[model samples]
Target: MKFQDYKVTDINLADWGQKEINIAETEMPGLMALRKEYSSSQPLKGANIVGCLHMTIQTAVLIETLIALGASVRWSSCNIFSTQDHAAAAIASKNIPVFAWKGETEEEYNWCIEKTLSGSDTWAPNLMIDDGGDLTKIVHEKYPGLL
Candidate 1:
């Protein structure tokens, strides 16, 4: 996804968030190993993934790992108040379209989920990873064609 399409709280925090992601990569050996094992095969090649979860440092690592395995991804935070802005920034910096921020209103939260579902004409997520089921609910209600 284009970097400009992302709607994160801050782009400036990317450096800090990237550092945290780097640290997390070291701590998450299993995911890292999976990346190393499958990157060449690209098992998820051409797959589009939409993820709704807490926007945290650990999640950043997971997002990057997904990319490494050859999936295109769009992400959103499950809870408006649970997003780590820096983590959002970092993921966005990598050109993974993200629609989330801290303190989002109800309307904003729904908007974010919509964005994740219909982010790009070239990429419509075939796989969903949702935490609180909001993403699933919205997709079912508004974009049943996807199911």
Candidate 2:
């Protein structure tokens, strides 16, 4: 609930986080299978996926699936209260780059979204997946090339 830097390599914590992801997978059978298939196909190779969604188990699975599909993903929470602490832990465990947390103030929330939107030229997100259109608007206004 507080601000702290957690690296994905924190083995003990990451394992617990990974377990959370596994649990999420159980409830997301279709996405799990899709991730397996996409991992093999790599359809989104070289693509960056910037997502603005609730940081929950469901979202964690989707993030993993996107990586498995060969995407470089940057994820942030759509709502301050919607972050699943354990889900974020699990994602951080996998060493996935994520920025968002529960109980974020408006300033912190906007800062997270801004940070996620920053990217290298080619690696900048070509596709924006958002629940409320925040990411698209940010990119369109700040980094028009990504649009």
Candidate 1 C-alpha lDDT tens digits along 50-132 = 99999898999999889899898999999989999999999999888899899999999989988889865767889999999
Sliding window of 10 residues with minimal summed lDDT for model 2? 2-11
- Stretches off by above 4 angstroms in model 1 are none
Best by lDDT: 1
TM-score between candidate 2 and the true structure: 0.84
**Per-prediction TM-score to the true structure, in the order listed:** 0.95, 0.84
Root mean square deviation (Cα) for candidate 1: 1.4
Estimate, for each residue in 8-124, the C-alpha lDDT of model 2 and write its tens digit: 223345556667777878988898888877688899898878888998888888888888888888888888889877777777666566777788888988888887776545466
